[model samples]
Target: MKDFSAEITYKTSRSSGAGGQNVNKVETAVTAIWNVMESAVFRFDEKLRISEKLKNRINSEGLLQMTASESRTQVQNKKIVTEKMLDLVEKALFVPKKRLATKPSKGQIQKRIDNKKKLSEKKENRKFRF
Candidate 1:
């Protein structure tokens, strides 16, 4: 997992979901922001890869924001938000191995052609002779 200690910043706000009575009164939810531009963890290539993958998630200023308010307690919510942010960063940093281009096996190709021939024969039987 990529270390994101320097990459992340956090803020708190009132939670809007779940807890009924206490929800309105307490500011328990946490909003975590990871500023990609300021992070020392990402090398130039890694940064570019992350930026491209997270194009939709990042704001115009390039800050990735995550909010969690599941629990009524501020600390719990903070933990949730941080966990989510870390997961996002981990996913963004992951590099999928390149796939080798391959053609269908001869047997599989023959099977597909046979199926098409059978289907065409079935359709031909449905038509009426004029």
Candidate 2:
């Protein structure tokens, strides 16, 4: 996997949770900001695809943003945000292959019809009327 770390910009702020006094004093939370329009890593079409696919995550300024504060330490949180940003971009650019149309073979269709007839006959016979 190509590391797109060069394309990202990180900001730090004081985060909440799990650290003693450090939580209030130190900036542990990491926010990764990547400008989709400015990134040279991807082509124009791929950038468009990423923008459209991740519209909710992208801001008005066209920067894709992700934040990580789950960890108590700055390094760990930075790792989390970077990985998350990469993963989100990877998923956004993904396009699934189109499936070909298929039909049941003649024998399989006949067998299905035969089974339906058998079921219908069995149910009809179960109606025990004089």
Writing each residue's lDDT as its tens digit, candidate 1 over 6-65 gives: 556778887887788888888898888988867787788887878898889899998988
Candidate 2: TM-score?
0.94
lDDT string, candidate 2, 13-52, tens digits: 9998788999989999999999999988888999899999
lDDT per model, in order? 0.84, 0.91
Model 2 spans > 4 angstroms off? none
Candidate 2 total steric clashes: 0
Which stretches in model 1 have alpha-carbon errors above 4 Å? 107-130
> How much is the lDDT of residue 51 in candidate 2?
93
Clashing pairs in 1: none
